[model samples]
Target: MKKRNLIGIVLLLVLLLGILPISSLALDEPALNSKKILLIDTASERTLIDRMADARAEPASLTKIMTALVVLDAVDRGTVSLDQNITASAAVLSDMVEDGSTSNIVPGETMSIR
Candidate 1:
């Protein structure tokens, strides 16, 4: 009886482990309403969601220039426009280095895409 219970529990765990990832994928990419997203755990310094987050290039104004280019791409695709306001969230700001050069955008502040 004990052996049967253990087997049942193991099977249940295996089924749940297999189903969880598929169920998460069915969330329509988390409904973020964005073309791509990246999420990291600040405490663990580990990546949670890694979709094009590691886009590679030499570090030539990598931060500001890349940011501008993404905004431009969104503009070109008609998903966002130069006149549209985009608010910088805490998550976005968290990606920045406090002592490093910056675009000077404050968290929660809304600015135009242009």
Candidate 2:
């Protein structure tokens, strides 16, 4: 009975040793933290650097230029004309003043394009 118990303990140790190595090898690789980015030279029309630039958090105000381009295109296509006069009613002026949009247009003022 003593010999049987010693043999059982040795077999258990051998099984645990075999399983430990397999589990260690199965661990995932460490994650990559770095990302690649591009920098361009406007005058040369080429890539100045092909490396990671400063990390940007979020895109802000990037579409404003595109919005301006679309509005200009609409005006150029005659969908809008400079001769069109816009009157600032009390409601429009109040909203502009409340929202703090840049313009000196007063209430009840008539505005025409130059």
TM-scores of all candidate predictions against the true structure: 0.42, 0.30
Tally clashing residue pairs in candidate 1. Answer: 0
Local lDDT at 73 for model 1: 89
Best by the TM-score measure: 1
The local distance difference test score of model 1 is: 0.76
Q: Check candidate 2 and list the clashing pairs.
A: none
Candidate 1 lDDT tens digits, 12-99? 9998888776666664545566445578899999988877656753354756778788888888899987888888898967886666
Local accuracy of candidate 2 as per-residue lDDT tens digits, 1-27: 999999999999999888786767786
Model 2 vs. true fold: TM: 0.30
List candidate 2 segments past 4 Å from native: 1-71, 97-102
The TM-score obtained by model 1 is 0.42
* Candidate 1 positional error at 67, Å: 1.9
